[model samples]
Target: MALLDADARHPITLPDGTLYRDTVYLKNVIDHPRIKVGDFSYYTHSGKPEDTAAILAPYLGHSVRERLVIGKFVQIARGSYFITSSANHPMTGFTTYPFRIFKPETFGYKDLPVRDTVVEHDVWIGHNAAIMPGVRIGTGAIVAAASVVARDVPPYAVVGGNPASLIRMRYSDDIISELLSIAWWDWSLDKIEANLDALTLGDMEALRRA
Candidate 1:
């Protein structure tokens, strides 16, 4: 039997064996031009599956310059959202108020700088976390519940709190580097399944041999 189905829209099954409709595979649910989600990345929410894109990144419009790139195996909890560069108001002027957006013809801050928001592979974002514009969350990072992430999160680090400070590193620098080199998330599903014990057990020797 397969461990998981990447194509399944509602991937989670409750203990009672009923499909958990609140959780959806982001790639299967989202069709936004500005958003890119890798296979097996899922987000939990109570809204309709079709509204996944809007709910995940509310400010990312079709015509917006910025992009939201999420990598494989990302687990996003409920109420977590990305505030992309498109949501930023013009800060070059004296006042931050968006006067041009009032009119349809000049309804944007086209001159403002924009940057893509990137969440790398194997990242686990906890509930109610808000990722600020253009923040690059590194691979294997953990964002704790209710965090207001305003800066980049290093790989394998556990971050929490309002400004999302690093709580601790999951592994030493060498181990993190080795894991990055291994890049288990890029492995084929069969290989990943075959090596599940090493991954789950945190046996570096076994993983290295695999």
Candidate 2:
């Protein structure tokens, strides 16, 4: 209420030129079995997975373009921006009227396709990172702080910085192959516990020896 009242006092608005207090919008989220929206996460008004993915197609996978994904165990932390889409000016070279009044065909959106936000299992995206449209962050991956992830991140890799690049792989190629071969994360808890000796500390060759 204080910010709204403050905005009313003067013509000054926020840096994004966005006025008013705040609003949240969610839509068409489906098949989320174990997903949890944290208490601090905030969804923007009219944020659509489909619309956002349309702009992100060049940077993502077919799964991301599906527009219907389960945000299984998604953790959209505090103050982060999960933008589904954005509206640009009509580009008349000087057609600056108002942001909303521009025609749909002007700034590119005559054929706006919608996509889904799929944060696969065991993914950890850091605070204030922008998961741009249609990007698919793979399972067990970690996105670092204040990053602009504009591409599909490989499974189990740790990424950071704008147009986020590969700093390094989390495991050796041999270890990665072993983990994928084991694929125990998808197993039931009991099954994992039953095979605890195999899950950790057991070399792939050791399993072969067993």
For candidate 2, write residues 1-210 as lDDT tens digits.
Answer: 222121121222579887423322122221232222321122322344334323222233332223423233334433455444333224454764544535654533433465555666556677778777667877657888788888888877999999888777777777767666666555555555566576467556654433
Model 1 lDDT per residue over 1-210, tens place = 789898899998989999899999999989999899999999999999999998999989999899999999999999999999887888877998988888999976888888899999999999999999999999999999999999999999999999999999999999999999999999999999999999999999999999
Q: Total clashing residue pairs per candidate?
A: 0, 4
Query: Model 1: how far is 7 from its true place, Å?
Result: 0.9
Query: Least lDDT summed over 10 consecutive residues: which range in candidate 1?
Result: 84-93
Candidate 1: C-alpha lDDT: 0.95
Q: Compute each candidate's TM-score over C-alphas.
A: 0.98, 0.50
C-alpha lDDT (0 to 100) for residue 61 of candidate 1:
94
Query: In model 1, where do residues sit more than 4 Å from their true spots?
Result: none
